[model samples]
Structures are given as structure tokens and as C-alpha cells.
Target chain A: MKNIFERNVSGMTERLSRSVIGIAGCGGIGSSAAVSLVRAGVGKLIIADHDRVEPSNLNRQYFFFGDIGEKKTAALRERLLQINPDCVIEAYDKKLEREDLASIFENADILIEAFDKAESKQWLIEEWASVFPERPVISGNGLAGYGDFASLRIRKTGNIYFCGDGKSSDASGLCSARVAVVANMQANLAIELIMNKTGDVK
Target chain B: MGKITVNGHEIDWNDNMTVRNVLDRMKYSFRMLVIKVNGTIVKREDWETFPVPEGADVKVIHLMSGG
Candidate 1:
């Protein structure tokens, strides 16, 4: 009699156990993504973000009110443990710098770019393509404002899977539903990538 | 009139134009943003059919990278 998670993902777990998921941001999308990946049974996660929880984030972020002001990486790491104790969660509570890119991404099977800053987003994508060409990275956009959720499109770009709309919440204040919808999709994309569900040619 | 480029070509400017209109004219379907306009950062909302005065300098950069 094992947990539902363990039972449902046993096969995926064995495969994903060796898979390492790297997320660059732990705000709305990253936090929700971490939860989804844990539920999906990704073996290991490296969560990094240099921000603290704010009252404004509580509306969309999965974190509770009590967790406000806490560092996002720490909270994600702690909460992910509750969802799947066996899943290894590594938290790096700092902004991703170019120097940290190679070492941080050394073992990642898949990378999730959830950074809120546009400049950081550009750098990570550029660096990964040049330095870590083999690893797959998933990036999200356009989960902001109140638009038709149907507009969300998941596109594949080379080794990168561009999730959601590729738009910024900063441009259109993020709503709970939209954030959840996009983040969930991103998580599912990560799971599919790990499970080889997308019929990847490579 | 200043030249605004997307990908590479200069875009025509008019008061009637919006960001979406400009994007439509460019025939670009890829998600665009994390962009710069003459070295200045422009928001996505600004790309939504926002009319540009004559002679506006522009540059469009995509959000995701391959590396």
C-alpha cells in the first residue's frame, strides 16, 4: 500500500529519478511548477530565485499567507519535500549569474526559465544555447492580464520548449487562474519531456 | 523619420499604427519581447498597436534563447 503518487508514477519515477529539473525563478510560475513536477515525480529539482515572498505574491503564488516574506527558494524547497519526500530538492536563493550557469546546469536534464527579469531571461537562454546545447530548457510567456486562456500556445524551439504565451506578467498583472493555467501547462510540458511523451526525434 | 527594425527591416511609422499592427505587418508569428528599441526597453503593451509617431527607432527581440 504505497501513496497514490508513488503508485501512479512508479515507472516515471524510475526514469525521472535520474532526471534533474532546474528552475530559475520561484515566483508564481516556478512555485506552481515545482508542485506539479513533484506530483509528476521528477526525481530531482534545483530551485533558484533571488526574491522573497511579498503580500502581493500570495494571491497567485502557491505559498500561504504565513509564508510571506520568506525566501522563495527556501519555501519551494521545504514545500516540495512535503509533496514528495523522496524527491531531492536543492534550493539556490540567489539570482542566476553567468558564472553560476555552467556549474548550476551541469546535471540538469531539463531547465525551466521562470525568471521575472527580462535581461536575466535573455542571458539564460543565450548562455544555455551556447554553453549547454544538449540540455533541454522550457520557457514560459504571456500568462499575464485577463485574456482568453485559449490563447496559450506551447511551441517547441530547438531544444527549448516555449510554454504558455511568452508574455510577461509585469506588463499585465498576473491573475490567479491565468498563472495557474500557464504554470500547470509548463509543468506538464516538463513531465512530458522527461517521459518522452512528445515523440522527440532527438 | 527614424527607422524601426524587427528582425532586420525598417518599419513604416504612422499615428494610426499599434504594436499589434506593426507585428502583423512584419509577418512575425513567434512570441516577441524581452526586446529593445534603439537600445531602449519597450513593454509588450507598447507592442499592441500603439501608434508610433513618425521617425521612431525600434528593435524587437524574442524572449527565449537556445543555449
Candidate 2:
């Protein structure tokens, strides 16, 4: 019998199945990116988050009503597993520190920064760049509010790919559509990096 | 008078115009910004002190939070 992802574009299934992605911060961006990657048949994922699902998250996060109160990493892991039972997933329900990041993400081929706080995002990029200088990190910023989709763009700086408008904030509010757009952009970049056979930074 | 490029647009610059001055002059009120001068990151604390050289390229990227 053909596998669930066998029909995927030539070489995509095999390539994605061999990749391992690490996601930090299982919020709107992290959960959405996780689901997209899982659906694309990625081989493995390592996710970490200290937050719990709340009613507020339902508006934009990829969580069900039943997942309320559950730790984000646990809830997202369950959802991802339901989508792809064969995919290996490692979930951590704790905030990751700088010293612990390298070992936790040791096996990951790529890292995705899905943090919601500016300080956290800055910390992740700096630490990731210092610890895993060669690995590409996909991050999102300014994905709040609505409309002005044209401002949302993918920016590359060094080994990091930032996907978002780089401007919107909580003052303008957050919506599901805009958040998902940025999250999916990050996922798409991750997939592209994984599929690049030459392994050169694109 | 000198000129510096900000996000690709050439803007008039005055002597001793720091990153903070440019943002104020341009009326960019965003609180969260990642400012860079000539490809080097200028931390938020240094924006008031980091002076932009003539013909330098300044990129002011705003960062927002949702996820």
C-alpha cells in the first residue's frame, strides 16, 4: 500500500521524512508551524513551551477547546501525533534556558523561533546564533493585527529567516488569519531549507 | 548636510544625528524596533547614542508579538 505522503511531489516525502525540526515557544506561531510541518510529513519534531492553553489562545492558537489548561507542548504534541502517527515527537513542558538549548536541540536539523515576546525572540536568535551558528533558524515577528498583508515579508539576515510584517503589535490586536499567514510562511521557509539538496543557505 | 539611506530611501542627515534622532525626525513611534547601521545591530539602549555616519545604511525593523 502506498504511504500517506507517497503522492507528495517528487522527493519531497523522503526529504521531509528525514528532517528533524526544533520549535521553541508553542504558541500561535509554534503550534501552527508544528501542524503544517506534521501535515507535510516531517520525520521528527522537538517542541518546548511553558504556557498552558487558555481561552484567549483559542482565537489564534491551534488548540481545541478540550485542550484548555493543558500544557502547550503536550497539547500540540497530541494534535501533531493525531495527524502523523509515524512522526517522532519530543515535547517539553518547560521554558528552555540558554544553557540547555544546545543539548535539547542537538539532533534538530533546523530551529524555528515562535516566541511572542520581543525579549524572548531576541534572546533565541542571539543564543541560537551563538550555540548553533550553522543551523538555519526561522522566526516570526510583527504578525499581529489585520490587513496590510503586503507588509508581511520574508527577510533573511545571516542564517535566520524572519517572516512577518516587522511592525504590527498588540495595540492593533491579533487575529487568526494574520497569525497563520506568518506561521505558514515560517513553515514554508523551513521546508524549503530542508529540501535544498545543496545544503547552501538560500 | 549629509544623507543616509533608511530602508532604501535616502534621507537628509544632520551632523551628530544619532539613531534616536532619525527615528524622532521620521516620526517612527513604534516601541519595539530592531535597528541596524551598516549591517551591524544597534541595541535599543544604544539607539540614543549610536551615531549614523554619512552615507551609512540604516534599517529600522519593528518587531511585534502574537505568537
Candidate 3:
């Protein structure tokens, strides 16, 4: 039988199939990143979020209309499993706290900080970096508003890879296109970091 | 005049010019921002008092939403 990932000619599928990626948050960025990772053949994922799907999320978040009112982690898990039934997914439908960090991210090779709140992002980066200094963390920041897609780019600071324009305001509002662009950037960077190992890609 | 680099642009700096002053002078009104001075992150509470010395490198990163 022809494998679904046979078209992954770069040999990344094989390597990705053995890696476990962790995502914190399940909104627009988290959901989009999760879907992309699963489709890219990543074998394992650990996702945590306390949010529930709402009608407003349908504009950008990766959830169906029927998924409204469902826990984001649970809904996303269902969608991801449909993408790759063989992929191992661990979904936690609760707010992730410092106490749960170790057990939740123990096996993940990389951590994706997909939070929306500024304070949450700061705490996640600080805690995750302090706890897992060696693990690469791909984070999204300043990805609100619309247009200016060219400004969105990847920036590496220490072990954290920030993907976005680094300028948009929280009050500027958000659109689906820009959110997905940043999320996909985070996903793509995660794959590159996973494959390259050194994370020295220029 | 002494100068400091902010977000890659060199701007004139004066003695005792704090992060808050710099943001005000630069017209950066974003509420959610990460200010780094000389490679050190300045906490939100210290924005008004954290001094940006001459020749220091500063990066003001704005944090936004969408997931």
C-alpha cells in the first residue's frame, strides 16, 4: 500500500514521525499550528488549552461550527486524529499551570507558545525557558490586524523563535489571514528546527 | 548629543531618559509591549523608571493577539 507520506521526498516525514511537539493554547494559532504539524507527518503531539470553541473562533480558529461549545483541546484532537489516525495525540482540556509543565512537556522535542494574552506569553516563555532551556520554543507575537504580510518574519532570540511582525497592537484586532500566516510560520519553523537539530538555519 | 539604538534606529538620548520617556518620544502607544534594554527585559512596572543609558541597545517588541 502506498503510504500517505510518500510524497514527503525530503525524508522529513521519517524524522518527524518520531518527534513529539507540544502546543500551549488552542485558539487560532495553536489550532492552525496543530493541524499543520499533523498534516506534515509529525508523529506525536501534546496540546493543552482551557478554552471552549465559540462562534467567534470560527473566523480564524481551526474548528467546525459543530465544534462550538466543545473544549478546544478535545475538538482539536478530534480534528487532528482525522488527519493522521496513526499520530499519537495527548490532549489536556485544562488551563496549564507551572505545576503541570514538567509532566505535560516531558517528551516534547519543541514547545510552541500559541497563547493570546501578553502576560501568558511572557510567563510561558520565562517558565518554559527556565525549565527546558535546551528545547526550542516557537512563539507567535504581534500577529493581529490585516495586510502587511511582508512584515511578518521569523526572529530567533536565544532558544525562542518569534514569528510575526513584532509590531501589531492587541487592540488592532485580528483577521484569519494574518493569524494563519503566523501560525504556519511557527509550524514551518518547528519542522525546520526539528530536521536541522542545530536550529542554525539562516 | 548621546544616542541609543531603538528597534534598530538610533535616536538621540539624554541623561535620565527612561523607557517610558523613550516610548512617549517615539509615539509608541501600544499597551502590550516587551521592552528590552541592553539585552535585558524591562518589566512593565519598571517602564517608567528603567533608565536607557546612552549607547544602550533597546528593542521594544509589541505583543498582539489572534490565538
Candidate 4:
């Protein structure tokens, strides 16, 4: 395992291979971010979602036709392992409840909020922060419609870090290209935090 | 008695000004927002009750994406 990762990846091998990330919601953002982190050599991931893939998810989510009936967390775990066979993935087959966050994601170095509903997004963020005040929560918001790619951005409030234009409502429409951009940005920020976390070499 | 700032703009602050009141004053009807008052996060459920004192620095982030 070490030999394969050594050959495939370059810098921060020791750090990434030991890190653990937690993600809530297995939609486009969560699915894509998990893949990118695994490719970047993140050692473990804990993903959860209560929904099953439907034909509609193909528009932006990272799932195949065969994954249509599979639960999102289960399907995503399979996909992540396919990329890094040794990478540890703990997939829960249910939506996250506020009370389950600390116990489920206690070891997560960082948390990602990828839910679609406005209320869900707000609820998870605040709940997670209340439980893990020291950890950061990366969120995706406002990547909807067309020709306003610049509308998407990143913002930080205390322990909460979010990415979006803060104006684009997904209810109106969500473009694949824009969603991918924000997903990658969230993944990139996660990498940055892990790499720059001041002596986190475990 | 004094005023508070929201996203760099000054708004008149009054007694018993909660986070919800500020949102209404600013006309921020967006559903996905990350609000903070003086660097302290104000949860969505607490919007109606979280206090925003005079001269408090508030951040009302308007989130644009859903998933």
C-alpha cells in the first residue's frame, strides 16, 4: 500500500495517508469531494446519506447507471475504494441526525456539508459546530443557473467555512459545470487545511 | 441606542435587536445564510432570539447554492 501511494502521489504522503475526513450528504458535492480527497491520498473517509440514487442524479452527481438503486453512501464507498483499495471508508446508510454527528464523526479532521435543501444546510452546519467547535465545516452553496460562474465564492465565519456565490438558488436551476467547480473548491480547501494544520503529522 | 454593521454597511441598531430583526431590516430573505454576530455563529433556530447588541459586527452571508 505504501509503495503504491509513494509511486502515485508526490508531496505530503505521510500526512494525507493518515488523515480522516467526514462528509454528510452524498450528492454532487459530497461524492465529488470524496473522490478527489481519496485521489489526493487521504487515508480514510466517513460518508453518510439516506437517499438512493435515481436517474435524476446523473446530471451532476458522480454515480453511474448501475448505482441508480444503491444507497448513496454505499455506492460512494465502493467508488472510493476502487480508486485506493487500501483507503479506509466508513459509510453509513442514513441521513445524519444532529445527535449522531459527534459520535459518528468524532475522529474526522474536517467535515463537509453537501446537502441540497436550504434548511438542511443551515441545520447541519450549526449543529456540527455546536458539537465540534474546534473543527471546521466546509459547505457548498449558491451554484445554480447559468453564466454567473463568478457568483460562486468562499466565505469563513468563525469555524464555518462555506463556498458559493450567496445568490444563486439551486431551486431555479443547477448547472453541472458550476457544481463541479464548487465541489473541487471544497476539496481543494480540505487539502489545504490538512496540509497546513500546524504539526498534524499523525 | 447605537448602530451595528452588517457586511461592512452600517445600520441603525436599537434595543432588543435580534438576528431576525436585522435580517428583516436588511431584507435578506434568502433561506441559506451563515449568520454571525461578533464572530459568534447564530444558528438558524436562534435567529429569532439571538441578541445583536449595539456596535456588534454582524456577518449575514447569503448562500447561493443548494447541493
Tens digits of lDDT, candidate 4, A1-202:
6665666445667788888888888998899999998988988998989999999998989999999999888889999988889899998898788888889998999998888887788778888878888888998877776677766678887878888776778778776778878888898898888888887544
Cα displacement (angstroms), candidate 2, residue A67, comes to 0.9
- Per-residue lDDT of candidate 3, residues A1-202 (tens digit): 1276878758788788888999999998999999999989998999999989999999889999999899999899999998889999999888988778878888899999999887788667766766787788888988989999899999865676789987786588888999999999999999988888753322
Q: Which residue pairs show backbone clashes in model 2?
A: none
User: How good is chain A of candidate 4, measured by TM-score?
Assistant: 0.94
State the displacement of the C-alpha of residue A31, model 2, in Å, after optimal TM-score superposition: 0.6
lDDT (Cα, tens digit) per residue for candidate 2, span B1-67: 7899998888998899899998987789977666768866676667899989999898876666767
TM-score of the B chain in each candidate versus the native B chain: 0.60, 0.94, 0.96, 0.93
Best-to-worst DockQ order: 4, 2, 3, 1
Candidates in order, TM-scores: namely 0.73, 0.81, 0.80, 0.93
Q: Please give the TM-score of chain B in predicted model 4.
A: 0.93
How would you order the candidates by TM-score, starting with the best?
4, 2, 3, 1
Which of the predicted structures, 1 or 4, would earn the higher DockQ when compared with the native?
A: 4
> Which digits, one per residue and each the tens of the lDDT, describe model 1 over residues B1-67?
4455654677766556666766677776766354344434445545664555555555554663211
Error of 4 at A32 (Å): 0.6
Kindly report which residue stretches of model 2 are placed more than 4 angstroms away from their true locations once superposed: A197-202, B1-60
**Candidate 4 off by > 4 Å:** A3-10
Candidate 2 recovers what fraction of true contacts?
Answer: 0.60
Q: Highest TM-score: which candidate?
A: 4
Residue A6, candidate 2: C-alpha displacement in angstroms: 2.9
